[model samples]
Target: MAALTTDSAKTDPLIRITDLTFIYPGSVKPVLRQLNLDFHQGERVGIMAPNGSGKTTLFYLLMGLLKPDSGTIEIFGKPVRSEKEFENIRKRIGMLFQDSDDQLFSPTVLEDVAFGPLNLGKKPAEAKLIARDTLNQLGLEGFENRVTHKLSGGEKRLVSLATVLAMEPEVLLLDEPSNGLDEETKTRLITHLSDLDLSYMIISHDHDFLYELAQSNYTMKNGQLEPMERMHIHYHSHPHTSHRH
Candidate 1:
């Protein structure tokens, strides 16, 4: 299949894949077949597909959380082939997991948010500064000493996101970011994301949210990802509930 690509994807790829393929353990069929994609700098891409279509698998592969069966993944012109290489690549990219609880563990929100920077070799004071700045950026300025487990779902989501942002990555991968947020919190999340000037991809089941944020969209099917257009807004608010594939 011809992969859909943006103009910048062809001219200046920040994340490039060539003939990517993968199969899960204990599975007979390959989940991805010669798949190709190019995520460019400063692009806001939304990836969507039906359930169990390997959307999350693709994100995991890009982050080197899982190794591909075949093909090359290049970031910033360097091909990732080893753990050391991926470690370097990860410093430039931050991935937010689907579960907020999985990312937040420290007793206090500030400590949890500072974890990434601390792990990256920053001093405690420096890491705290980054964490505070990140939280402030996300409209959580006074949440520094709050108990992490006591926050609402939306607060947890924002705090988890702040953890990733504190790393100061050039690229962000947000998966199911709006999962547990209420409409008001979701709107706040959207506004915060809109103001972040960076290259990123959001994987979501929420079509309406994706439509508002993504400049380009794609859907995965039959082990391939291809371009898709946003369905007209009127179709959603009404009962139709259909979308482009």
Candidate 2:
């Protein structure tokens, strides 16, 4: 299938994948086949697919965690083919892992959130301040010194997001962000993400969440992305009537 381009493709995209193909070692078939995508700045894109459809693999390829067997990947208008090139890309694009436990490792919430900024060369004090502000932005102001492992699932998810936001990334790649959240927590997450200005691409199975957050939606089929219409829900009011006996 031909890859679909966004309407704003005339402008340079933040990330571009052209004819990308990948195959696992010793596998008889390619997991991804001639995939093409263009992600522009300030766009909220959602991707939905069944398990083992190469959705997460696509994300890994974008971040240079996995190399493509064929085709090219360009970020910020430059071709990326090496880890050294991907280092800068990683700084600009933050990824929120599907599992919060895989993301947070520091003993304290502040430390986990500040780790990215520190690696980016910010002073310890400055990194802490960034962490605090990120937490505050997420309505987690008092969680600075909380024990990382002791936090609830929702809190950990928010803190994991805080760790990514602390680096001030231009784009975010969120994997199943609403996976384990309660309805209330999911609502909170939706509100918080709606208020952010950054561009993001979310991979999720929750159509409701995607409809709420994504401006553009796509479905992954046979290792390719095809544009899809957003799902909409309508409401109706019913009136009760008394029956005479």
lDDT of 2 by residue, 1-245 (tens): 12334445557899989999999889978889999998888999999888999999999999999999999999999999999999999999999999999999999999999999999999999999999999999999899999999999999999999999999999999999999999889989999999999999999988668878999988888888988865421111334363211
- The per-residue C-alpha lDDT of model 1 at residue 194 equals 86
Estimate the lDDT of model 2: 0.91
Per-residue alpha-carbon lDDT of model 1 for 1-245, expressed as tens digits?
24544545467799998989999999988898888998888899998888788888999999999999999999998899888999998889999989988989999999999999999999999999999999989999999999999999999999998999999999999998988789889989889888988899999888767876888888888888888865632135446445443
Global Cα lDDT for candidate 1: 0.88
lDDT, candidate 1, at 176:
86
Question: Which residue pairs in model 2 clash with each other?
Answer: none
Query: Against the correct fold, how does model 1 do in TM-score?
Result: 0.91
Clashing pairs in 1: none
Return the TM-score for candidate 2, rounded to 2 decimals. Answer: 0.91
Model 1 poorest ten-residue lDDT run: 232-241
Model 2 stretches astray by more than 4 angstroms: 1-10, 232-245
Number of clashes recorded per candidate: 0, 0
